[model samples]
Target: MARPAVTLDNYDDVYRYYLDHRQNLLSARIAYAALSARFRPRVHYADGARERLQALLASGTRLIVVANHLTDRDQYTLAATAWQTPLRSVIGRTRVLAKDELFTDPRLRRAIDLMGSIPVFRSQNHGLRAVADAGRRMMDVSAQRLQRGDVLAIFPEGTCNDGDPRRIQRLNTGVGHIAVKARKLGAPPALLALGIAYGPDPSVRGSADVYVGDPVLELPTTPMDITRAVAEQLQAAVDDVRAVR
Candidate 1:
């Protein structure tokens, strides 16, 4: 009845899987980093999160950077923001929770695999039970990674929405569930709330900011209240960052 608590050893197979595909991961990390630099993405952040995150990283805080999934540009935005710290958003360095669709394509698959993205299946019009099951699966992965002190990033909104950062799309409650599960385990990594959007001039290169807000809610959020709490806190981080204009 203990749910067979997730552990780093439980993820040894995944690590082996990654090791077998190491070259592809290396290639992807290089390409994405090159693309980021070639485009010269700019950042305009206001929160102490930049420093706080660096400190957390240095202090061994496993960070779960929740970003706003926007255009392809959002990835670059994260790269630039990450540059401010010792940790760069190099694909192979951390795990990303991405949609299952991205894993199916061949050409794109290699790159995504290299980017350290774990595919997550999201069924449209599925019942909440199915959704919750899928979320727990993801949590197993997240929990395993956190147990090893690896950073994980996910887009809680579940899709790209290139709109006002303050006016975000509805977020699926899965991320909240993961946070809750992690907290319950008492060793879950820090799920720092981050808001990434088109700086001010996203159309042009090097002209926007990736705003990161305060940690809205610490991990181990009340299990009963977690699903809603993660969404509300993450949304608040976005709205609060956007309001700084």
Candidate 2:
């Protein structure tokens, strides 16, 4: 049988479906292998970041990983680079928030599902009024997943930054809301800012620079405040990658 389509109207059902779904290890390995073979980006880490990340994971603390959005292939490079870093441990345990359209293609959807991706109905794609309820539900689901010990990875900028690859775009407050909600649910996730910088021509392989920042254990209480703090930290990470590249 064909899988039921994911839509805003049926978001609650889809969310429930994800809650019961488990990532296939074999599928995840195959997907990561493909990503690694195609994108050979160099990975860089901030001072003490490597040790801190391992400690956090060892303590069972979930991560809310936020990264800059660059080209369409940014996620591929990010995943490939992550496989070469301490992040490899959470490959199948992380739930990535990806736009809804990406799940529309059957061939690509299988890989996304295997990678533990949750469909996000963005306001830009569905209109603010249309996505309001579904957006709130999505945030709730994300928080619940964190509480369940799943690492949450989000591209908070919501869209690719075409104007400047080195600078991070304004982040949406959704990530902040998700963090705050998860904390209120008794699951405070550590924040990890990952920065990705592509060379002048992003289309070329091996021109990506991926930087991982030290995890932020404590975040601001309010959503806007958390968003602002995340933006500042993300910009610093981006600068670090640009400096080395």
Candidate 3:
């Protein structure tokens, strides 16, 4: 039997309670795992999603899917599968690199921990030490997960952009760091850049399109190369999906 869905009817109270009980985000993870169980996600564009993801995972590529940040709640759609997919599948429980502030909330912190999040610091950029530390931490956590055969999905744009004729900004360096770090371990994971757009024109249905293509660039020796490749693939995917446009 299919599991029943959960509702946040009393979310405000629940949220407050969680905040009072926060403990280094450990409790948050358990709560999140429990809450995540309530959702039953269906892909907006299942057309090639399954096939593409399966093929990439089958190829023994520690997959890192760099998707453009969009407000259609794209990240959650992808994250749902991370904890639910088969062990050998690309969607197997993933470690996300989300903003640090989200963890400050007890309930949110729990969700992040349960979701297996890795805090990506965007502040303290005035010093190189903070930058290096953030990079090293990301490398350690993500690399460990990849070595254990888990995929990592990140939004290079960091946050969603809201506007008509949606826009994607320049790719972030974090994606590149992930690629290079994995490569240095002697088995570089494949970077899958995707462009997800939603529409039905005058009538909005469940219509959506996700165009995927070959890697923009293979694993590189340096982080810069990986970041550039992510940007290239992102543009390519968007074009491939909307080539008819």
Candidate 4:
């Protein structure tokens, strides 16, 4: 059966589709290869972080991967760097939360789909009142996917940082909500923070430094508390990348 085409009129259905869908392995490999060739980001892991990540994945534990957003090209750089890490083991099994606008172009949409991206309708683009229900549905779908053992990658800052790339912006609470919900659903995903920093002149093809922090196996009880803890850890990751760069 043909999968239903994703349309604005069927927002709920769209989320449901991605909840269980994994990217095709061949497509994921080709896409990452292209990104790696173009970006060639330098990747760094905190002491024991790489080994911990390998262990967590080996144990079949799902991860809520959060990163600090810098330039529009940060995603490409992160993807390239990730390909150089243990993350390559789960390329087709990871779900990246991306702004919905990226899905408008048919040609780019196919590539984004191959990267296993999930569309996120932000309140800034659609207005808070307008995107409220869609936001809830997106979170619910994300939580369900986590419970199903899919890796969830998110930029909790929600948008690119226009100011100092070294300092992480305030993160939205949506990530915390998803984590809490996923725990309640019996998944209890581990948290992984990825920090990215570009050179003085940042661009789509510029080389970057990426840091992978140690994973957090236990989460705070409440959403606000969880967000706070994630913020602290992500900032530390960002600092690590900057110090090494």
TM-score of each model, in listed order: 0.74, 0.96, 0.66, 0.95
Error of 4 at 132 (Å): 0.9
The sequence of per-residue lDDT tens digits that candidate 2 reaches over residues 73-93 is 877887787677777888888
Candidate whose TM-score is highest? 2
lDDT of 3 by residue, 1-245 (tens): 22111113332332233222213344434444443354333223224654666666776778787777665456454443343433123322455666656656777665655555656555442244544654566566676566666667788877666654355776668777767767767667877666666554412333345544554225667889778777777766666656533
TM-score of 3: 0.66
Which ranges of candidate 4 are over 4 A from the true structure?
1-9, 204-206
**Model 1 — which ten-residue stretch has the worst lDDT?**
1-10
lDDT of 2 at 10: 80
Each prediction's Cα RMSD? 6.3, 1.5, 9.6, 1.5
Q: Against the true structure, candidate 1 has what lDDT?
A: 0.59
**Total clashing pairs for each candidate:** 5, 0, 3, 0
Error of 2 at 134 (Å): 0.5
Model 3: how far residue 32 lies from native, Å: 11
State each model's CA lDDT, in order.
Answer: 0.59, 0.87, 0.56, 0.87
Over 110-208, each residue of candidate 4 has an lDDT whose tens digit, in order, gives 888898899998888878987888888999999998888889999999999988877889999999999999999999989999989878677746558
